[model samples]
Target: MNLRKEILVTGAAGFVGRETVKQLLAEGWKVRALVRTADTNPLAFHAGLSVQEVGDIAAVADWSSLVSGCDVVVHLAARAHKTGEGPNAARELFRRVNVDATVELAKAAAAARVKRLVFVSSAGVMGDFSARPFTEADPPQPASEYAISKWQAEQALREICRQSNMELVVLRPVLVYGPGNPGNLERLMRLVASGLPLPLASVDNRRSLLNVRHLATIIGRALELAEANGKTVLLADGNDLSTPELVRTFAKGMGIKARLFPIPPLLLLAAARLLGRSHDAERLLGSLQVDVTLKTNLFGALPREETLRGLIETGQAGR
Candidate 1:
């Protein structure tokens, strides 16, 4: 696990992939970014990185050449959205990208004698957040197409590693947020910034979040430590924040008072169902938390507990 060795990063154009690549480059690692097209450049900001155009991982073309000189493979490419497409379409796309492509990549990595394969998995595979505080040991009860695909990918990767004798490390991170976040967190921030009254004050649910910097640091440490081999780690900032508190914190950080109305949870759920936005209700009202003690103890490093403060600071800086 020498920092000077080469590593192949799939989905290098993605949010987490971009940050991870930056960290790896900063550590003096040679990065070979696998992209779909030669023109699909990420925010590398002119950092000196080797780029390879391997179109559509599902096609299963020669990936051995891609990882020929790499010591590690970090798989970050997957279908990550939840809406717009139907469930069947989503499942099929995810299976192709997450499951089939991942297996093929691992096989190629093993063929290339790569030392480690790190898979970025989603915590949603643990199931909906109805229950607070889920751990890595919890039986996977994936409730959505996205979650199911991630779980299947993990299984496929493990089986491939078992047959090929390659080291596998799976990391499940919850709601990774940072300055350029583009998911639900960004949507909420936009709404809060508009000074509109949000009906999330009554939702008393706690959820775990990971800052991108912390996540990148954990990935780097996992690569360096051999003890992380054949292990699954759930990553979080070791702090849980309620929906109201999160919104209020963001609002206050933006120099505005939070305009929140405490609506009944049941009524909100019904409204969400009628509007075909049940995911929104589930996220705001559901209680899903994680314990990062195992990750901290294993790596001898802990994520900062000042998640809200960090978010505020980073978000404002970005603004």
Candidate 2:
């Protein structure tokens, strides 16, 4: 009988998925990468990796055969957030992909007798802004359809796991950033590269962010840590960077100078609100810190210099 521990990873082509699969392979775990398409798979060069093409994660039925025999399933696929979506439409779309699909996958994992299911959830489930660092004790108040869907999915998975006696580990990470990252981070990178004077110097809000590699490390640890079973924990770098600081750091990482000027927080908010961008205002001018001591205390702090180096490398990579 083969003694290797087998693991299944969904969304194997995504940023975090790619890194997680690579790290698992390096650690000698047999990885079954489930991706929507096999063509140009990032895991192609990886040795000893099993690739399964399961197009449209949300629509897939009968995951039992694929999940059978895997020790753990790391689920990372979901419907990405979009701008200017109506409440009803957004809810239904998010439910279709994030909630409905995830519950289906969890049911399959449970049926397969998988020991654990590590789910990648967003910190947005706690809302876009928080005056203080969010903790596990706080009740969820999801602010958007995407976040609401994730929150609902978490609840559903918890019940499913409870009923099936399967371990569920949910990780909520805030604003993951790395090379080739999309969303606001990529937009910020572009803005910084433009050398345009940004009126964010006076904004004194703390934002927590996670590096893709760091998140991957956490996922790996969750798979092995018995203490992590049946827990919902938040993941962050534990280093909070303000908007100005982030801009400066990103600029420095790119070997350029940041052009920034002080702008009143209230004024920024008013302008954003006027432009029908309250969400953008809150993200830019508000704080969304998360208490990540739970993971840091277990793994120790990721050195600031190491993280800065990663930022620089990511910036240089120009993605």
Candidate 3:
């Protein structure tokens, strides 16, 4: 008569996935993790955790073996932003991996009578032209190959779930940062830790960031909340900051003084272009924010003090 729910987590070896698996396990839910390989197993030492090694998500034609008997399927596997391919090649690769594989998995989950499927998407699907914080009501304007593929996948899943008995929930989270986080946030942390003077004091752009821990908790809530079904949620920490503010906050977390000086935003952009780092400058100087009220409605608002503490802890961990 035990009615504990069983959840299947795809890409359970990745950063966010690992945290999600840990949270779910701590909550007493039986977890079945589907990873690409045994070598990539993140929960290897955990007792009673069921793991399946499925090689190459893009190549998996059938997901029945891993998805059956699972009440919720959290699909987190996707071909992230991969560079150095031609336009056609990139499109095909993205379609094959993010779109096709996702659709196939959703179909299998529906057939298996899964109650819900939660898709982890990216905020990049909103594109780079947001005049303000992006909300779920905004029309999608995905620009990159990865974003395009995710948007397509969302559309496909919505239609598929609309036709099937299973429910679908899509979550588009802003740049997720936390312990062992990679990419731009990590690079920024490294720069701040090096004690180098930064010229980002004058860049007055706002950005929204989500902590991986919070994202994991949100995923769990999405699975349990029936109201979350058939909805796309835009996620952030509910605290937006300028690049200078972020640098200062990160420095505060690392216990270092931010030696930031004022530099004209236009001048910074020109210098970045001259140095062949336009994209880097754009991220630092451009505004990329998200509306997290929907998320707050589901999981409650994340306190600003708690968010800063988490960022500080993440910075300390990176050291």
> Which structure among the candidates has the greatest lDDT?
3
- Which of the two, 1 or 3, has more TM-score? 3
lDDT of 1: 0.82
Each model's C-alpha lDDT? 0.82, 0.85, 0.86
Across residues 269-296, which tens digit of lDDT does each residue of candidate 2 receive?
8898899887777778889999987878
Native-to-model Cα distance after best TM-score fit, residue 41 in candidate 3, in Å: 2.2
Candidate 3's residue-wise lDDT over 1-319, tens digit each? Answer: 1226789998899889999998888777788888889975767566537888888898887788878899999999888753333323568889999999999999999999999999999999998646699988998998778889999999999999999999989999999988888777888899999998999888878899998999999998888798898889999999887888888878887877889998899999999899888777788899999888888998778889878888888778766
Which rank order by TM-score, best down to worst? 2, 3, 1
Sequence-dependent TM-score of model 3: 0.94
- Say which candidate scores most in TM-score: 2
Clashing pairs in 1: none
Better of 1 and 3 by lDDT: 3
TM-score for each model: 0.92, 0.95, 0.94
What TM-score number comes out for model 2? 0.95
